[model samples]
Target: MISEKNKSNRAKQQTNHTAGRTSFVRLRQIRSESDEHLIDFFKEVRWSKKKGKFVTPATEEKHNEMVAKYSKLEPEKQTKDVVASIFREVLGHRPGYARGLGEMVIPESSRQNTVEKFAALTERAERHEKDAEYYKNQLEELGGNVEKVLAKQAEYDKLLSSYMESQRQTQGESHRETQGPA
Candidate 1:
């Protein structure tokens, strides 16, 4: 049988260990909360878990091309929504786990607050319709410029054809006149 004194000493040791773990956890939580890169770290890890979703050089190039091609589009494309969507798709339906350090449960109020904030963002996006229309008009003007260039080219083609035909006729008439009424 273990002696009472030894048992008490073990209990004391366990208590110290528990206190150490508790303080460590609190410090970690504070660090995570205050670290600006925490969200970025989470996002990077989550998306990188998917093979092709992570940004590669080729993907970056393609994104740049798309951005350039659609430069006139209103409401700049933000990767935040895409990254958040990835997280939701991956984790939103997963079972809740709050047992240990790894398990995290977002409070219902916090979730509701996030939803409200996103709702406001959606409203702001809706309000940007006029700006989007303006961009569409700019795109239409570029198309119109292309059409004008095509029309001008066609007009020049017709003028050249007429001028060539007139020249040919004048040369023939001059040759015939020089032949002295052949």
Candidate 2:
């Protein structure tokens, strides 16, 4: 029931769409290539034909966490590949979507490594805050006088150095001390 002119126009449109679009890679291909640990990730993404959307069972916090973790994975891990595929699968090759997905996933490092580094950094920051609080309390206790605080600090440093000096006896001094009044 279509005219040749309309059919030609449709073909032209299809060609244009196909030219610009990168369809989602099939899941079978992804499964074969993906690591065993990512099986949980696979289970998280599902398509809903009736709703025409993905049925991710993640709460907002969980989804954001997953995005963060996935972003930090190496480019070679097929993480982005899986993300792109799922993205296109759910959203389709949307018209004019050529931004390259560059900053969407910020790569910090491998997840375990990044997490450990983050933990260490966080612990350091907490320790620094505690030290700052202690120093602030000490300064306040010095009656808000900068000179007094500096003097106290200098006194503490002198005392600490004196203790250190006593602990480190020269060989000659030790020998003289042991020989005593000879």
TM-score of 1: 0.35
- Across residues 25-124, which tens digit of lDDT does each residue of candidate 1 receive? 3544665655323224332332334354533443334334434433444555535444334334432334553212223544335678889999999999
Off by over 4 Å in 1: 1-108, 127-131, 179-182
- The window of 10 residues in a row where model 1 has the poorest summed lDDT is 13-22
What lDDT does the true structure give each of the candidates? Answer: 0.53, 0.52
Model 2 C-alpha lDDT per residue in residues 137-166, reported as the tens digit of each score: 997877668878889999999999988887
TM-score of each: 0.35, 0.23
Clashes of each: 0, 0
